[model samples]
Target: MRSILPFALALLALPAASAQQQPYTPPKHTAPPPPGIARSTPEEVAQQADGGTQIERDRPATYALAEHRRLTRALGTLLPQRKGVVDAYVLSIALDSDPVFGREAREAGKVLARRYDAVGRTITLGGSDGKAPSPLPMGSPANLEAALARIAEVMDEQEDVLVLYTTSHGAPFGVVYNDGNEGFGAISPRRLAALLRAHRIERRLLIISACYSGVFVPPLSGPQSAVFSAAASDRSSFGCAAENDWTFFGDALVNRALRKPQPLEAAVTAAIAEIATWETRGKLKPSLPQQSIGVEVQAWLKPLEARMPKVATAPVGKPSVDSLQAP
Candidate 1:
């Protein structure tokens, strides 16, 4: 009976052992390779249409030469031989890629020059190509440096006040300097402060129109300077689209408020109010434009203010697409 039971258990164990010894094998079937296309390097790909490698263009040198000539001429015009109580030197720079900024900056410069009787003394730096009749040269950093040097050369460092109005796209880092075709870098607050200090431009009325332009106020402000920014450091301003004629800040501050025969402080206050209304109507965040007038700068600005040409105040209107139409 024991032998019979052992034999039955051994039969079951033998079947298990035989299954473990022989591993399962899958059927061999190869997959077809993916459809192949001709491989080519970037240069070769670019040349496929022409059947030859495209030659790199060397137009930068030519552009540089032309820009240099224009800069020299523009700088020559900004120099005033005789020094006045307030030789208002307007430097209107459009540092954005949008064409609207270029147009707005040029127009604002023209208006400021007329108001201050600084037609020849004004130096405008815009983003337009040299083919057009522009008041100033390109708005590049090098060109700005040269223009500042020219101002220093002509301006009385101690008495004269420099009215610099820069319109651009701004960031937390700094004000952007962009040419539509050729890319440029930003102008940091520190760098701008250094540029002004280097030129000994102590007495200044600096108006910055951009998003987060309040970042410029601290670095640029001093006892002899009046800094006005379009927006708070943490906020963004409105009406800076490519199609718009003027930024919300620019239109409110320059086109509407400053255009009136009023004090600079009063104009800024009025502009702020107008900007608030515009933002409310558009359902946008408030920019909260900033202004810092140093104690010494106020007295200096008074005499300059008196000399400004009295102009009729135009009715303030809401920004519209039709405003983009060329005059």
Candidate 2:
């Protein structure tokens, strides 16, 4: 699995310039999409006269977009529940220039972390404060670098990590970074994959919520890793929501999907389908949702499927490191 990680994880010496932080490139082939793609359909414009989903409307083109949004929420409530120590790093840098929605994303991370599992193990997440001074200046790159570094450090110091999630926006060709072309912004997929290998993280799982995130899978998806995204490489993701504030994909995963009782992949796939349908009904071109794994997560589950050991119950302040065991 390590041999197949992306370039970012391949060369992990730099604090911020790892392979994931590839140089910026303005996509020349693809032209800008129409502006209405960003417009809000709202109530009257919704496919349903009720201006909601799960309910039907008999209006013109407007009514078709009114979905109730009950889809992924059901799945979130059904995703398989687990217990483990998670070193979460939520980086929200909405200050970036390219219409970033980091602040809301950070909040989504917290929402997922709370119900993600509080007992049976400990979870240490950095960037919970919303803003962490990362290697990248203040964009997608910053979020990615902070996330990768946290994972590397945790693996080097701890063991048996369950998941790693990075949520942010991305340009067609790359993730946003610190400068218009510097440390901050989004990191590349290959570079991110390399970070996982360089840190020697085993059995890692990644969930990336971003627009055009499909571009990342080719380079970052791993044999031992499981990944989920908000939008395909060719489509623009919906964000800038009033409440979620980030992308709808992130909201579905953290707020809705995490609340479910299914396994990780099942929950994610359901969320992808729900979001795609919601967008399509709303007059927006449907974005493709994909689940591509180098190695099926299910393949590695059989050996450890029997039963996990209970976590040590030593007193909180007097915790004993020697008693630590994989749960």
Scored by TM-score, the top model is 1
lDDT of 1 by residue, 208-228 (tens): 999989988999999999999
Summing lDDT over every window of 10 consecutive residues in candidate 2, give the lowest-scoring window: 314-323
lDDT of each: 0.73, 0.43
Model 1 / residue 232 / CA error / Å: 0.8
- TM-score for model 1? 0.76
Candidate 2 lDDT for residue 87: 32
> After superposing candidate 1, which stretches have Cα over 4 Å from the reference?
1-59, 129-136, 313-327
Off by over 4 Å in 2: 1-100, 115-147, 156-159, 178-184, 241-244, 294-296, 299-327
lDDT of 1 at 319: 53
